[model samples]
Structures are given as C-alpha cells and as structure tokens.
Target: MLDYSVRTATTHTPEFLGLPQGAWVQEGGPQFAGQGVVVGLIDTGIDPTHPSFADDLSTDSYPVPAHYSGICEVTNDFPSGSCNRKLVGARHFAASAITRGVFNASQDLASPSDSDGHGTHTASIAAGNHGIPVVVAGHQFGNASGMAPRAHIAVYKALYKSFGGFAADVVAAIDQAAEDNVDIISLSITPNRRPPGLATFFNPIDMALLSAVKAGIFVVQAAGNTGPSPKSMSSYSPWIFTVGASAHDRVYNNYVVLGNNLTIQGVGLAPGTDGDSMYSLIAAPHALKNNTVSPTEMSLGECQDSSRLDADLIKGKILVCSYSIRFVLGLSSVKQALDTANNVSAAGVIFYLDPFVLGFQLNPTPMRMPGLIIPSSDDSKVFLTYYNDSLVRDETSGRIVRFDAVAKILGGLNPNYGNSAPKVMFYSARGPDPEDNSLSNADILKPNLIAPGSSIWGAWSSLGLDSAEFAGESFAMLSGTSMAAPHVAGLAALIKQKFPSFSPAAIASALSTTTTLSDRQGKPIMAQRTYSNPDSTQSPATAFDMGNGFVNATAALDPGIIFDCAQ
Candidate 1:
C-alpha cells in the first residue's frame, strides 16, 4: 500500500512540520547544482516524471547510455515506461532463503516499482528538483528539493516490491555504482532479519560496500528507527555514514485516552462539559491492538470511540496491539475515544502485543486535536494484564471485553526548547559495533556519522496514490533514518562538487568532524551516554545500538578538521 500522488515539497510552509524545506537552497542551492555528478541511489526505483523531477535528467532514459562496469554482470532487463502521471522504471533480483540454506537460494528480483514507498522517498530527498510548486493541505508549497538539487541520479532497483531480496543484489548494486563512477551511493535498505550464524559467512554486500568506499564513493545508510534498545542498529559497517531521526519544531496535536484501571498521574482530572483541557499527562505514543498480519487504519471517529471508559468491555478488555499501523491510525483511535467519552459512553478497548513492531508519535497537523501515541514497550504491561484476565475469565462472561484507548493532552508538553530542540528523534537506533561484540553482529568501526532523518515527505507511485483513501490530497510524511541518509549523501555530492580530489574516507571524516556529538536537543548520543556499570541504571555498550553522532551537513561541507585514511 504505497501512495504515489503525494509529492514531496521544498518550502517550510508549516503545513507539514515547518521543517527546513528550502534550507539547503537558501544560499543559491548546492555548489553542484548541475555539474553532472552522477549519484547512484540504490533502493527501490524512482518515478522520473514526478512533477518535482519530471524535467531533471535520469540515467534510465539518458540518450548517452552509461556503463554498468562491475564485477557482477549488469543488465537493463528492467523495463521503463511513463504514465500520464509518472515515469517508472522496473528491475528485479534474487533473494537467499535463510531456512532453506544458501545452496537452495534462487534469484528473486522482480519488476521493481515502489510497491513500498520507502525507496522513492529516499531518492527524492537525495537529488530531487530545485524549484517546483507543491500543493499540500490546500496550500501551495515549493517542489521536491534535495540537498543536492541538481545532481543526476542513477537509480538501482535493488530492494524489491515486497521488500524481499538477497543481500547479494545489494553487493552487486554497490559494485555497479563504483564501476559506473557514481559520486555518491545512497543505501536506504537494510536486512529485514539478522539470520542466525549468518554473520560467520562473508557477506558479499558488506564487501561491496567496502569496495565502494575504497573506490572513493561516499556511502550513506539508515541508522534504523528501532530506538533506545541495544538491538536496534540497522547497519554498522564503518565504511558508511549512518543516520538518525529527530522531531521537528512544528507540533501536530493529536490525542489518546488511558485505560480505566491504569491511571497516568501527571494528566489532569477527567473531562468536564466546560471545554477542552490543554495539559498532556505524558509525552508518549499510545498503544493499540493489532493482528500481526492485518493492516490498521485510524480515523478521528476511532479516537473518539476509544475514550469511552464506561463501556461494558472496560471491565474485561484485552488490548491486542502492534506498532506497524500508520500514525494516522494511532491519532484517529485517540480522537475517536475522546468523542465517545464526550457522549458519556463506557466502552473500553484492550490492546494485545504482537512481536517485533515499532510505535510512533503524532506530529502537529493543521487541524488540531488532543492526542498522544505510546511506545509499544510502555503499553506491553497493560496489554498483558488484560490478556491474562481474558485467559482466566469465567465461561459466563461474553467475548473478551476489548476497549481501544488513546491518550489526549491536558498540558505540559510544550514544543519549544533551546538548542535542544525536538529535531533529534529518540527512536533513532544507536550502535556500538556488533562485529566486535558477541551480543551483536555489526562492525565496530562503522556508521561514522548521522544525518537528518525524521518526518521526511517525498514522491509517491501512481499505484500507491490510488490505494490510499485518506491523506490522499497531498504528499506522504514518512520518518526514518532512511530519509536522513540521503541528505548526507547529497551533501557528499556537494563536497565532491567542490573538492573533486577528496577521497571517500576524507569525505566521511569531514562529515563526522563537522557533526555535533549531541543531537538537536543537545543530548549526548553514541558512546558518551550509554549505561556501562551495574548500578541498575548502567549497562554494557552494545554494538546493536548507537553507531555515531548525528551528521552536520553544513559542517561536513566545510570541516575544520578531516581524517586522512592515507596515514
């Protein structure tokens, strides 16, 4: 379910999150506006005819066809076509099945379109158009502007539609990018699962990444959005730049309600008929029940419905939950619950936990509502309580009482802060180099830097656009290190534009030096703030979390100091 019509814009129009839309271009755009530096975006393919990029050059249809000179054979077997709305190119690769072992693995790449919208968004953020007016929420904002607005793109459809593919294809793509002499290689895809005992085998993709680095191509990868845990690191190879997510200055008010028995202390008293309250009890994501295989859609009505604690089900509700649902579902669930309460209803929803899901928060939207989203970890206890209750309930009771709950604001959660602004998101993965540590499998000296990754909006596929019923009027706002990695990649292109002789190591060093060790909120990240002792508050530094500091694009472009790999 990808939405293609939601075009990413370039102005800080406050419609979304008031992010620095044209910040990269404020000073007459990047130094490499059109120097013909080829940047290879290795992810899902791109939609060249996107209004923001329709006129820009694409490697897909360049009359002067480029070479894909790599150790792995390259071919243009993927077809290219343009619809009245978009220009799409397709490609495929094979995947290795873990359960069946390597010998049984087969080629799995299929015609690639962004069946999932992650790749398209990543590409746009790295090299989108410089000036095109984008309309969102009835306001006309500028176009799909990237850090390197004028760089030419060589898109590799390495990640398949279902996000199923082998790591070998990724390695092949990297080799091709290097042979093609791409200025920067942006990788937004990571392994979906860390196979048992697989790290013992030499990963061809890791080797390819190393090769690309040696060839002087700057590699930028997503740090992953799994959060404060030690097992959330996405990519830990020292050869590439890893990125994190941060909250924007803008606030999109949404709400969630607490369960009847579970009382959140800080929030104000129950609602009154006088009017809406303003304080927020907790600055967190509210939990929701989800079926592992089912997709959940949230609406305002749902949020209102969840607030009715008096409903019969509240007494025995079992909350089945998952974090995979879209942010919209969380917001709507909260709003619906509140409305139900206003009407003096008593139904409660129970949330049950499904394994391996991530939770999210709501950003400020133009239409204001009081809501909050809870992290999956925080809601697990509540869910387990009701789940256990259901298992032991007497046969006389009817279907397990299920009441959905969403949190709403009462006050206290302000959006303003000093340099510690909400720019750096807490959920961004951390790392300590798993390869060097037995608990994790990541390389110790990798993911040297961080970049801008949060609620990044971008282009959508024609197929995706048609499937989305709501949020259909404009661009999609997605958050992840995937979005942030490209910003750094584009910056690398700009550096190459200025200092053509600089090697990839120099570029990585420059970026790392220029970045702030702390996040936008001024919180010390990386090795600086890990729990290292056994004081109940301290733990070991695990490579699976906190790779490096956040990236400083402005500083990387003109670093005061640089690391010389030659030494």
Candidate 2:
C-alpha cells in the first residue's frame, strides 16, 4: 500500500549520512559517487524519459560495462528510443503473470516504462539525473538528486502494475540481471511469504539472488515491513544486503486532532498543512463478528464489508476502521471500502491502528471520502478511552456523542515536526534471521542494517501518477524498507566504484562492520514495532531491531580494508 503523497523536494543520500562532507571525504579518500558502476533495478521497469534519467549530466566514464550482455528489449509498446545513456538497459518478464492470466496487457504497460511510479522513483533514488526540477500541484519543491547521481542504471521489469508477477517471474528477472553482468542489483521486491520449513536456497528467488551475488554483484533487498516483531522477516538470504528502514531527521508526519482535541502524530508522505481537513469521526467499540464468522472480528469502519456494518449507523458518518485480528470478513482492499462507502453514502473514513498489530502501513487506497490512517500511539489511547467513556452512555436515549478529527499533513512549507534521525522506523521488519539456516549451514543475522527510508522524496513518473491519489506531481515521496534498500544500493554502487575488485561479501562486511548503534539522542538505537517497560511507549531495541545499526556511508567508504573468503 505505498500510499505516499508528493513531497516538496528534499536533498538526502550518502551525503545525508555524511559522504563528501564527512571525514572520509575530507581525508581525500576516494569519494566515489558511483562513477562507472551500473545498478540493475529488478522491480517494475523504469521510465527513461523522466527528468531524472536525462543524459545531460551522465558521466562518460564507461560505455556500458564489458560484461553487460542485456539488450534493450524493444516491443511496440516500448520503442528502442526509451533506452538512453542514463538507463543503459531495459527488459521485462511477464511469463508467470501471463501464465497466471494476471497480466492484462491492455491495462498494464508492455514496455520498461514504469506505469507504476515505484520503479522510476527507486531508480532515481539509486542513479537518477542529478538536480532535476520538482513541482507538486504547482508548488515549487527545490531540485532533487539521487544517491549515486553519476552511476548507470539498468532495469529489469519483474514486478508489474498492481503487483503482478509471481515468484517464478522474479526468479527469471534475477537470472536476467545476472546475465546482464550488472555491478550491483537493487531489488526492492518483497516476498509475500517465507517458504515453510525450507532453506532460503529452496526458494527460487533466494537461489537466483545467491547466484547473482556469486557473480560479484552486491545484492540489496528490502527487509520486509513487518517490523519490531522479532522473526517476522521475509528476505532472509544471508548472502544479500537485506536492508531495513530508519527515519531521517526530516519526518513526514500526519497529525490527527480528534474532536476531543487529542492530537495524534503518525507517519506518511505529508502534503503539508495546506492539505489539512476536518471531518466527523465515528468509531465502533467492538470488532466482534456476527453469527456468520468468528467472534471478536471487526473493522472500525474500513469498509471491509458494508454489510457487516450497521448501515443505518455508519451512513453519513466518518468511519473509523481498526484491525482487531486480520479479522477481515470479505473486505480486501481500500477500494472495497470505497465501494461500501459509496453504497452507504458516508462522509469519509479514518483508519485507526489497533495497538496490537499497529503498523500504520504507508500504502493506501484512495477514498471516496477523505481517509487518514491514525497512528497507533495516539489512536490506541483514544480508542481505549473512548471505549471506556461509551460504557456509561445510554443507547436507549437515542443520542450519541460523536468525535470530530482534524487531519493535518505536515512537511515542506508547513511547520516542520522534525525527527531524530537514524532511529529504527517503527515499521522496519526486525530479524534474528527467521529461517533455520541449519540446512544451508549459513546462519546469519539479518536486516544487515538500516537506512533512511521513511517518507523519502524521489522522482516519480507522470504516467504512473495518474492512477495514484494525493500526488499530481512529477515526483512522489515513499516510505518503508522498499525506499531504504536503494539507499544502500546507491552506496553499494559507490563502494563498487571505489573497489571494483571487491566481492559482494566484502562489500556487505564493510557496511555491517561500520554501522552506528546510537541515534540522534546519543541513546541506544531502537527499532520499530517494539515496546518495553516503564511507560511501555518504547522499549530498548535489540540486534534484531537493527542488525548492525544505521548505515554510515562515510565510514563505509574507507573501512581500511576488507578480506574476502576463498581457498
């Protein structure tokens, strides 16, 4: 649910963690901004024509590496002109999606041009044209730059619009990336599940990535978003740079001020205060199911099933949806909720995070009425308090007290509610390596480390933006480990530039060994989705919270030296 609004431009990257300005760059150490390295993006394809991929500033250090065997696969939908110097290669894999009857050729683009903005945004994050102009809804956002502005980008279209493509498709994509002989692969693809009782190698994608790593390409994958929960990680391959997420000092906060004046702060790609709105709020106390389904199951008002709701009570009211237990009954996506709302003719819906599951997941579905996901921290307290207050209410009185909420999107032009950066994002999937490596005999700690992923601003495709909500801009902001992986991907490209002979293992070692443990507060770093004692608001993070810690590109640049294992 990559529900992010376009953000005013913000400059971040290896420099955000101290690249050229840091001591490493000061020492005249090689500050390689990925000069000759090529990054293979195996996600949805890329939009070559976006300002981010312009060849105006691309360096002519290498004319497509000698090992690159990949061709610019051309079709009617994707012409040969699409591949420029910046986007060195482009290809797509629809085998699995085609076989599954999920690939709707009519609706989804057949070429490498990303109809889904994710690929373009990610590609830009890795190696987009530096200093592209940005404007969102006519608002002037300053120029933006990629982490590795001078690096080359080759794209493999494995993931597709609406998340089409199966594991087999992903495997094929990896195989193609490997064949292309890319220097580094930044795979933002996340798996739906960890194969039960199977070694990581048993999974086709893992095997494929391992092969890519063996070929000397540094592989960076998104640590799953199911975070703070120890062992809920999915990208568990030991050989890959499984990257997790951390918040940058610049936070994208959405503030929801309830009718009771209880203002709660959550996260998303904020649209600034100008986008704020006020709405009537309604909440369902119990999520218990009726005779048809299990008990204690319900949605506050997420429109999971309009039938499950008291249509009379919910109509004309802002529905408050809560996740009790994945306690879903028929409602699958936010679209379904929109349909239900249209059916009921409701004003809007406010999604409150259940303290238990409490993700405040960034991906979102557009609403017929206004929709905002209330953060778990504040909403949980509100829910508990509201439930208690409702106990004394007399339903027979035929009068119900309602709560109104003010939704304020804060960032860019708005008063900045900044964050203490390098903190483990509440949603970054934690790890202790959820898999049993006994079979593969390669037990390794996971998420490798964290990077600035929360509400990251990057280039987006106008073709893709039409289908999405919130942003009518050329650039969009996204969050999650998906955004984090490319930060490392860009860094890996820089590392490759500095040491072209180093193996993937050596690059991973340098990154892991040089991580920082303390955060902006000078306190021990903490990961998301964790709670301890005292106030229980936040608990001490463990190795699983942040495998190594926040990534430091400056330190990683000159790790002194790295030793690769070989007989």
Candidate 3:
C-alpha cells in the first residue's frame, strides 16, 4: 500500500508498473496469471466478503480447489459460505493467547474473518480479482488490480491488536499453511526483535518458515520498516524471501496556499475542498487562550482539550498546528484537530510536520474538512509571516501586509511526484545485515525483492470500520513492507503456474535474478536514506535497498540459467 494521501488518478493499471498483467501482457507472452495456484498468507486474516477476494464479483458460491484442505472457519458474524473459489480457504489460530488468558474475545474474533485490514490488503495484492473500481475518499484511483488476479488465496490468521501476533500463533499458522499444501506463503509479520543468528532454525517463526521452504513452498517476508537506520532489518532468514518496500511512480498531492501568496504542496486524504477559497490563518499556539503549555506530542499536535483555544479568533480561519518530532500523529490526531476547527467553523487545518517524520511520507487521510499535512519543520514560519503581515498597522506604516490563506483540494487527478516511481519508501526497512554490528551482522543479504507496497489500494474489512475513507466502502489504501511481501508471493504463484515442476528456490531465483536496476526508461533507481543527520537524502537503491531491484515478471519467465543459491 503506497501511503494513500488521496491524490491522482493513474492512467495505467497495476501491470503498467510491470505487475498484475503489465509486463506479460505487453510482451504478449505466458498467460500464467496465477491460475490453478494457491497463495497462502499468514497475517491478521482477510475479509471474506471483499470484492477483491470474490471470483464471481460477489460473495456468492464458487468451487474450492481440489488440493485445498484448509477449512472455511464459520462464526456467528461470518458464515462458512464466505470462502469462495477466489478465497478458497480460511482458518484462525489464537490458541496460545486464549490459553494464556491474553486474548480478548470481545474485541478479537476466534474465527478466520479479518478483524484488522492488514491481512485483507496484502492477500488482495497477492492474488485478488482484477478490474475492481478502487475509490478512496470519493476519488477513483482508476481500477484496482492485484499482481496475480487468478491466484487462489488461503488465509492463516495469527495476529492480534497492540502486540501484533504471539510467536506461537504465527508459527502454528505457517505449519498449517504447509499442511494445507499451498504453493507460496507470504509472511509480513513483524519480528519481536532482530534474531540472534543468521540461520532461521532457532526462532519458532523462522523454523516454521524453514519447514515450509523445505516442503517446497516459496516464502516471502517483509524487511521490517525500521529503517533510515542501517542494519535494522528484523527478518534475516535466508530461506524466506525477505522483501523491502520502494516508492512507485505515484504521488498524492495535497497542497496549501497562504494569504501571502505562498503555495506549498503537501499530502493528505482531503476529499472535501472542491476548490480554493480564501481564509485567515490561526496558529495553534496563538489560539491557546489559557496558555497552558502542552507536554505531550498528541496534546500539542492535536490541540487537545487542555489547550483552550479562542473560538472567536479561530472562527472562519484555517488552524495551523505544530508538534515535536518524536511521534507521528495517528487518525485520532487528525480527528481531534478537526473537532477544534469545527467548533470555530474554521475553513480547514494544516499540520506542520515537526521534524523526524519526513514530509513525503504523509499519506492521504480521511478528514471531516479539507485538511493537508505540510511536511516541513519550519511551516510555522509561513503562518507567522502571514499572521504578522495581516495585522493592522499604525499611522506611521507605509503599507500593510495581509494574511489571506487559502486551501485547495489538489485531489486525485495530478500527484506531485507522479513519475518518481521506484524510490525506496521512507519507512521501508533497509539492510546489509539483519541486526547491528555489535550483534554480528550476517553476511547474507535480505529483502530479496521490492514491489508496489507503499500507499497501495486494496480491500478493507467492514468490521474494522474506523477509517473515514472506509466508512461503508469495500476497498481503501495503506502502506508498509507488509504490503510489499505479498507482491512477490503473487509473482511466485504465477511462476509456479508456468513452471509447476520448478522448486521454491528455483521460482525465487527466477524472480530475484530477472529484476531490473533501472526504471522503465533506464534511469538509475533511487533508494531512501535511513541513517543521516539530514535523513531525507535518497541514495542509489542497491541489493540492500531493493533485493534484485524491482521484480521483472516478464523477463523472469525465461531466465535461461536458474540462479540457485546455498542457504
């Protein structure tokens, strides 16, 4: 999922970026399309009813694959018939947590239905149906399609809220995936910590992956998103195809125009502002009527209750809020500011990115009003300049400066960085080794491949209806390495469809060796820099950044010599 900041309508399909059907269709070559193959995903599970998972375009009935032994888990909320041919199998595992009295049945379902949206998104990316109209915040992002539209999906639920998944649960899911005899397994589960050794035989999850691989199932895992910091990759298992995330040629452009005639481009999921309108700008610190100093990032950034704002001064103006660099504000932060602005009937809100989190990382977020996230440590300067200039002057003053700020939608028609595809995502994990040098960085390179993972559009869970973009919708957008790993998995399924006799290692080799270092036009690809005093500098994406660079499915179909390795 490329962070969906709600901008632009891509003129191309998923295949245009060399996946789903782009490269192969353009080449007019093998029509694999992942037909008759299974893509097993171990995550939080999936929405059985998402159009992305339905073969008949509805949650009606479809025949299950003959080899699929996985069960369609039935709960009071989710029925058994939900697992159709597209979603051939579904299962849940939370035994350790339930036995340990740690699982909350009230919030966490004991069934296979996805309570969280992560699994559904990744699964859809791997092998969901194609030509599904993807609309986020009322803006259609063309038609959404997956890497392998015809691939069958087998879900293994293991993750829970807060602390991700218990190790036992994740490991058990992998074992079941093997038992179910799925062709490929996608593991984007966040590691509890960096593994102590190179070989994956020690950790329970890694051990499960090793067994799955030995059983001839291709495994794909995420290079954790704790990057810009080198040697911070969590998944280091050689057998598992660890994937890193990279930026594609899609950018969501949400911009802001100041009263001082300064038009600063930003990003967000602002769907309301139809056109530009003039308004006054009010700073959050200035709106503080009580003047109580905020100590926490949320309190300051969100303009929480304790910070009493002057409603009189705020009415009919755009609120500019600022916070420290320590934490990135969540959806709650966006809602809180909207609440404050709504009280005064303010036009909109602009969140000044206080250092730490880079600007381009601001994805489109659903908002009550036209809200834009400005990625700048000094955006406050713009507000202050406007405010001061707008102040009424005395008799001695020659000319008066006016602060008439304006906000525009800059919606999903033209993204700012539309052509800057394949840049390593800001948060995509980077690595030459899995851990720091003190713990001994392994000689083995991780993140075997990169794919369309950031701000990706996919199916969402209705039960998890907390987002404004997904109030009653079937599909939404998100970003993470979790979104990246399944892409390779889908490709693996296609390779299997073409070369059924090829081993998992052989499939992995085809995908890995057949990757491209340059973009479609042969431009050198740029990688995101994780470690620096100035953290935004993008370097050349190497094998550490992108395993073999972006996955090239068309070329991979005929890599004459299989590049087998010793793992």
528-565 per-residue lDDT for model 1 (tens digits): 22222112232222223333455555555567777768
Give residue 192's lDDT in candidate 3 (0 to 100): 60
Best of the candidates, lDDT: 3
Candidate 1 Cα errors over 4 Å, as ranges: 1-34, 56-112, 136-144, 195-201, 254-419, 422-424, 438-446, 465-474, 518-548
Give the C-alpha lDDT of model 1: 0.47
Global CA lDDT of candidate 3, please? 0.69
Candidate 3, residues 433-475, lDDT tens digits: the string is 6433632545777667787677777778876532444545667
Using TM-score as the measure, the top candidate is: 3
> What TM-score fits each model?
0.61, 0.73, 0.84
Deviation in Å, model 1, residue 331 alpha carbon: 16
Q: Which rank order by lDDT, best down to worst?
A: 3, 2, 1
The candidate with the higher lDDT, 2 or 3, is: 3
lDDT tens readout by residue for model 2, 1-567 = 111111101355544677647633533432235767889998777777788877754445436566667788888767877776667899887776777676877656777777777888888888776667766544554667777777788998877765455777777778988888898998887767665556654677788888888877889999877776777677787788888888777543455555455666644332333334554444543222242222254543445666665566555555656644352222344455556655665565555565665433543222334445555645567754754464333368633434334333333233244445567777678776765533244367788888888767778776674234433457776777888898889887777777788889888878888888887778777554543221244555666777888898878878876757641
- Computed on alpha carbons, the lDDT of every model, listed in order, comes to 0.47, 0.66, 0.69
